[model samples]
Target: MKIYDEKHLKNIVLLGAPKAGKTLLAEDMVFEAGIIHRRGTIEGKNTVSDFHDIEQERGNSVFASSMHTEWRDYKINIIDTPGFDDFIGEMIAAVRVADTCVMVINAQHGVEVGTELIWDYIDQFQKPVLFAVNLVDHPRSNFDSALQSLKERFGNAVVQMQYPLNQGESFNAIIDLLKMVMYKFPPEGGKPEKLPIPASEKEKADRLHNELVEKAAENDEKLMEKYFEQGTLDEDEMREGLKLGMIHHEVFPVFVTSAKKNMGTGRMMGFIDNVAPCPAEAKPELSADGQELPIDPSKPAVLFVFKTHLEPNLGRLSFFKVISGEVTTASELVNSQTGAVERIHQLFIVDGKSRNPVDRLVAGDIGATLKLKDTYTNQTLHAKGYDITVQPITFPEPRIRTAVIAFSKNDDEKIGEVLHKIHHEDPTLMVAYSKEIKQLIISGQGELHLAVCKWYLENVYKLHVDFESPRISYRETIRKSANATYRHKKQSGGAGQFGEVHMKVEPYFEGMPEPTEFPVRGKEVIDLEWGGKLVFYNCIVGGVIDARFIPSILKGVMEKMEEGPITGSYVRDVRVMVYDGKMHPVDSNDISFKIAGMMAFKDAFLRCEPQLLEPICDVEIMLPEDVMGEVMGDLQTRRSLIMGMDSKGNYQVIKAKTPLAELDRYSTTLRSLSQGRARFTQTFSEFSSVPFELQQKLSKQLQEVEAV
Candidate 1:
């Protein structure tokens, strides 16, 4: 195959809500372009985009795949991304790198949350976008209602560039408003037969044509004048007017197709070839470090690594977007962050799991390279000293978390290694060992996201894992002060262990002295440092207690501070003043004073008001307006503090403060209540005093667990 430069090609991502038939459209496009031997069904697991085992078994695209095919004289790089919100990170990455975005809307379902999300992203980047109204042959498909709803919800810019010729089984032809021609299709795939509008559907065709002409006239003044003078527009003039309006965001051209039957796939390809925006066509300016960088192929190289992978077979496939300069095989690229240059050996344009070697690449191209050292997703690739890094892709923090482990326990040692591979591939999925809870917690956007990862582990890495709820990281604090004196006397045949010490324990509001507090506590609310000054005043004028044992007592106190009292949690924010004490010079050993210090700490902690602190999170929930009542009721049931409720257009946004324990699996419940329309984000807000009843329960549970 001849190498196609990025300048001649346009990359548009097919994105929408789940079950929008994006994979079927992909398969149909490949079959129509003559790139595949036969069209493959999603369930058959033979489609080009949904090739992975998990995707095939689930009948969906989990990962974004890069597919290249030609339409007309233009080269198109089509990206098919997962519609499930769990893998939304992939959709964000695709839109960031593409020149224009193609959002597919199911004719029956209308606009969904995923569609709205991608629309906002495109608006954010100021990228021109196209809308495809797909699945026209379905029984429940309503073209007029859907189109009207799109226009009402989005804007008046929605223009009917193409219309379906029939409904249900009769949906074999498409009427092109741009060319003013009817392309009819036979039962089998071939050149669609051209026919005149049937007598029964002529009135429908006339009404659609009048609406298109009026919209086109409204888009262009010249076309308006022609329409007013002649009461009609030439098909060519209307096409040009619609194209201009669409490219300028003045009009949204809606096309129709049945991807399952491969009907209208050929026409859809032609529309894309004629309308998809190349990198230069939209003239989007790339921004970095508050400066606009020109997309010059002759300039020094600048690319962004949008995705990463560490496949067992292929060590690493670092996918990147060429932003400025030309990148050819065998050349080297520098890591702008690390200042280390890596040699490029083989460049592969990835299509699903298979990769095609490309000889050379230029600006605005997306491709993959294997085994890049010191490189990961969101890293910048540029020339030496090129400090300009593309602004990172902003993603919502992972909300759901679960504790996972090796099912057989034999792969425990390899868990870390296997997770690193998964992390390299997915930046949104996070893994960490929580020392507080002693569980390996994995977090992602939702349940489907983590389920897909577990599936990947078993299928791709051949590892079985168990999933459980994550344990909370609670904290303990002391309330008051107490002083206690402890004495140790052990008589033996040779030497005797005799040590006595008296110390006063007080709350250390300022944390420890200079060593423990100043440096590490920078600006934290609590301070616990080891360099605190323990003043051993030696007030005993008679010197009953020797000074030699002071160091041992202080050391013991520090040890107790680490392995706290009441619970197995760390103790903080306290000061001990060892003003008076008596120690035997020879018999007063370190062990004797150490024991006294531990007893003193335990005594003081018990006297003080030691209370447990629970973590609270600031949560913001967004849902449709109709669900507001149920949402408020649910919040009250969860003991949530309602911050406020605001409106975003037709949607209601609820702000509240909720405990972390109550929100662990809230995403699943929210979907059930709102019919999969609600989404929320949570951030650690502050620590609050736990209720007395709850604290008592936790104390009892901790005691029982410790005893076991």
Candidate 2:
């Protein structure tokens, strides 16, 4: 294999909805480029992209696969990404490094929910895109309707570069408006023979050809003037104009393809190689400090690791793109995040499970290396003294959460280590040990996402884990002030412990001042490690309790706060004042004072009308408008407060505040209700008191569990 420069490298990513044949099209593209002799199908479970065992069982791509091929003297690095929303993290990583996105659309379904979802990401990255209407030979395929839908949803920027000459089931030929020629494929469908346009289709081809020339000319002033004078653009001029137009997102050329039959794939590859923006022409890579880095092989070496794979027997493989300069085998580079130097011993160009060893990876090329000691996904590796960090890929936050429990006692000891490995492979899947709830919480994009993680744990690591509904982190706080007193005395033949405490417990809020009715001797406001504040005021007029014992008293109060009087939940937003207390000279040690303080705080908390507060989250749901009524009604049942509503094209976004306790399995429920046409995200908002009836129920449930 020969190394390609930045100018001749095309980093293209395949993106679309699930079952849109993105993986099949990738197989065709690879086969068309002569990288492989025969194309593989998803059903066969032998495709280059979906090679993983899990993907083979599911018959869908679950991870992004990197493969490249040389065509027309240009190296096209094709990143085939999963279309399922649960695996959106893979697509995001691929899109981050891609120069152009080939969004495959299902001809039968037109624009689907998955396509719309990925379109938002493509728009976010501002990547030039080409639409490949795949599955054109399907019985229900509707190319015209699909084209109309594209025009309606994405505007006139979607211009047809090629259209199928025959309808569904008879789709064997494609008419190229750009070239003004027809490509008639053999019945077996490999390469097509080029011929003049049919007499019946010449008029329509001429009309679309003129439209293409006009769209291309609009990208440049000189091209527009030449088009006005010559009434059309020459082939060379139109290609240059289209390239410029694509860079600015002014044109999104649509191509026709029957990936299953290998129809129109060769022409799609030709357009990508000739017109798609190269690495140097696409957006410049930005450093972590917001400065654009030049894409030059002669500059200091800098690489961004976008994806990491833990192969069964091969160990860790870090897939990266050379952002600047060139990296060679056995060259040393520093991990920009850790500042640890690592040697790149063997670099390989990845093609799914197969790796082609390469001595060097130049700028704009994508490849993988094994055993990078200090390198991981989203980390930047650069030459020494360069000190430049590339901006990391931004992954979506986990949407669904559940507590993971080991099935066997022996597996418990190894769960954390296994989870850490899983997290390293997919950063979007998070594993957090909640000390307060005493559970290991695993969260991901949805139920399927976490399920896949569980499968990996059981199959790969041989550890069985089960997911359970996580306990809600409710807080207990008082609504009014109260006063209580307690006396502590212990005698066990040793130094007797005796201390009496009288204190006032009041609900605290930010900016509240100390009580002025009693003289303030000392004051300490401590912010609880969990949340809220505990303001302690010492108002002992004549040192009723020694000043040294005040901290001991506060500590006891905090201990009571940790295990609240009402429901054993953590207490918050309470202020305590030790205005009066009695201390014995010999027995009023820190231990005695702490016991007295704890008793006094608990007594007061019980008498002050305490309330249980549950966490609230701001949830934004995007769903089709047809399901808005049903979803909104369901939300009302969950005690949700509808905040606002907005429109996003054909979808509606419903913003609401709902208690986290009421949102268990909400992602799964929403998918069922909307037929998998809805997506949502939630973030912690604030905590609010639970309803009186709900509080009693929770208290009863807790008491029952404790009794057991």
Candidate 3:
């Protein structure tokens, strides 16, 4: 393989909704470049991208696959990403490394919920974007409607570059607005012949051509003057203006293609080679400290790992982008995060699962290397002594959680080990043991995401598991003040243990006044790890209880707080005052005082009107207008408080605050209710008091559990 310079390397990521034909579009591109003699279909399971077993089984891309094609003088490195929102982490990682984003829109369905969700990431990165209307030859395709939706959703930056002549099953021609020519493709759909625009389509073609010219000239002053002086700009001039417009995200050029039949991929590839912005021309990457890291070959070598895969029987493969300088097989770089020296052993330019060994890769180029220690996704490797770390991609938090159990008790530990390995490959899949819930919890984007993890565990690791709803982490707190007295005495042998504690407990709030009934000699405020605070005070007068014993008493109070007497949940936001206590100088010790204090606190808490606090989450659901009524009714059933509602283009956004317990399996429910036309995000809001009736029921359940 030949090496391309920074300016000649253009990296693009294919993104869109599922069934939008992104994988096929990538296949068509590689075939048009002559990299492959024949194209592969998703059904045939032979496509260069989507080569994974899971993708083939599901007929969808699950992981982002890398491929490169040489078009004209430019080397376009393509990263084909999964369209399902479940694998959004794969898409974000690809977007962070790519210079441009080509959103493949299905002509039959314009701007789907998945498409809108993916657009948020593209807009956030501010990457130059363009549209490729795929499946234009389908009988249900509507190119005009798709183009209109794009313009309405994306605003004036959208400009038309090409349009289909016939547009349905008989689609065979496309009018190029920039070149003012007609591309007539043969029935076989390759190597189109350029001809003059016919009179029947000339008027419509001329109007769109002028619009394209004006949109291009608006980006550069020189191009504008040329267009005004000569009444038109040449092809090269227009290309220059469009490239500048793309670089600044001022324009999003649209092109039509039938990727399934390979009708218009060649023209689109030609345009990408000529007009797309190269990696070097893109905005400079920012360091972790927010400093600009310019793309300069003369600078020290720096590479950023964007994705990693654990190939079956092949060890780990790390995919990276050369951000600055050139990397070769012999170079030794230091991991900025780990500070360990790693020598590059093998480097290759990847095309899906196929890797072509390369001696060197320059800045602005993407490639893969094998067997690097102490490096993974979002880590930066730089030349020794050059301290620079690139800002890592910010992945979204998991929205769904479940407790997983291995089928056999012997595989419990093994399941955890395998899950950690899985989490290493995909960060979005979170696995951890929740001590409060006493269950092994796994969280992810949605049900499908976790289902994929289960599939891997069963098929790849041979560990069968079951998922169950995880127990909620509830908190217990007091709502009033109460007092109790307890005396711990033991006389089993010569030395006896005796201690008495008299304490008052009350609900705690910030900036509350100190207790005036007893003199406050010492106070220790502790911030609970789960949430809230615990305040302890020593109010004994005249050394009624030794100062050293105060800590023992406080420890006992904390022990009771760990397992609240009401519901056996963690207790928070309460203050305790030990006003008086009796101790035997000979038998009194930390243990004696701890027991007395614990008993007294528990006795007082039961009489303090203890309440339960459950976790609440802020949920935002986006759905089509037609299904708003049904979705709203469902939310009401879930005890959701309608915080607000807003309109976003063709969708409705509903914001609600709901108890975490009621949100179990909500992602699956929402998908079913809206027929996959809706998407929602949830975040922890706060912990609030549970209703009296629910609290009574939970307390009764806890009593039953304790009895068992």
Best by TM-score: 3
Report lDDT (Cα) of residue 255, candidate 2: 96
Q: Which candidate do you rate higher for lDDT, 2 or 3? A: 3
RMSD (CA, angstroms), candidate 2: 1.7
Q: Residue-wise lDDT of candidate 2 within 628-707, one digit each (tens)?
A: 99899999999999999997766789999999988999988898899888888899999998999998998887788889
Assess the local accuracy of residue 181 in candidate 1 as a C-alpha lDDT between 0 and 100: 70
Query: How many pairs of residues collide in each model?
Result: 7, 0, 0
Query: TM-score-based ranking, best first?
Result: 3, 2, 1
lDDT minimum window of 10 residues, candidate 1? 517-526
Give the TM-score (vs. native) of candidate 2.
0.97
Give me the displacement of residue 231 in model 1, in angstroms: 9.2
Instruction: Residues 417-512, candidate 3: write the lDDT tens digits.
Output: 988878877888899998887899999999889888988889888899999999899999989999999999999898889899999999999999
**lDDT of candidate 1 over 124-155, digit per residue (tens):** 77666677888888888887777776787678
| Candidate 1 residue spans exceeding 4 A from truth | 173-177, 180-251, 283-288, 383-388, 407-410, 478-567, 570-599, 624-637, 647-651
Write down the worst ten-residue block by lDDT for model 2. Answer: 511-520
Error of 3 at 485 (Å): 1.3
Clashing pairs in 3: none
